[model samples]
Target: MHKEQEKVTDKNRFKSCMMKPDEEGNIYCPQGHAFTLEQRKESVKGRYPRTIQFYRNEHCEGCPLRSQCTRSKHGRTLQRTDKLAEMQIEIRENLMTETGQELMKQRSI
Candidate 1:
């Protein structure tokens, strides 16, 4: 993968592990604070174009995990996109199928 792609994936992995969005598109912090969708914009970060969704929370100011959670004075922030999310779901489903298992085995070679 490209360096930029790797960076994005790592950043996304970190955020997704820290905060996950539900089916209703609501993301919550580790302390159970809900993040609201701030904006949706089309962005071109790499060779591919994608739509970015920005989510933010306002309750991190006094939270004990603030320092550990985010460096932004504006509280915790997260970004995601529908395409990546859907791809993740599809990949998860693919990994369960026999063809995916075979593909994985081949990839280990």
Candidate 2:
């Protein structure tokens, strides 16, 4: 039996599994399609109140990677909460500090 070897390099390595939105608030799929904000919902009744934002890519109908990306006919969608976004920003800032860098290096994930 023969098996194919995986090709991984620095150019293709990703630090996080999730694709982050750009500074301008553009969310891109794994295939590089730009997703637009579709809706904003608030969950005031929930135990953890937060604002949810929805993003969708209209051009996914003809995308070759559609089947792999999603099973729904709605193409690809990304949902993020306002609190999560704020936390992400704060985490990024902390990760840039010396203490955060040392913490990252010490962790054994």
**Per-residue alpha-carbon lDDT of model 1 for 1-109, expressed as tens digits?**
1222344343353355446677786888877889988899997987989999888899998998777678888988788888987887788789779998899889989
Backbone collisions counted per model: 0, 0
* Model 1: lDDT of residue 13: 39
Alpha carbon lDDT at 87, candidate 2: 80
TM-score of each candidate? 0.75, 0.65
Q: What is the C-alpha lDDT of each candidate?
A: 0.76, 0.69
Per-residue CA lDDT of candidate 2, range 33-78, in tens?
Answer: 7988899998876577778888888888888767766777877777
- Per TM-score, the best of the predicted structures is 1
**Candidate 1 TM-score, C-alpha based:** 0.75
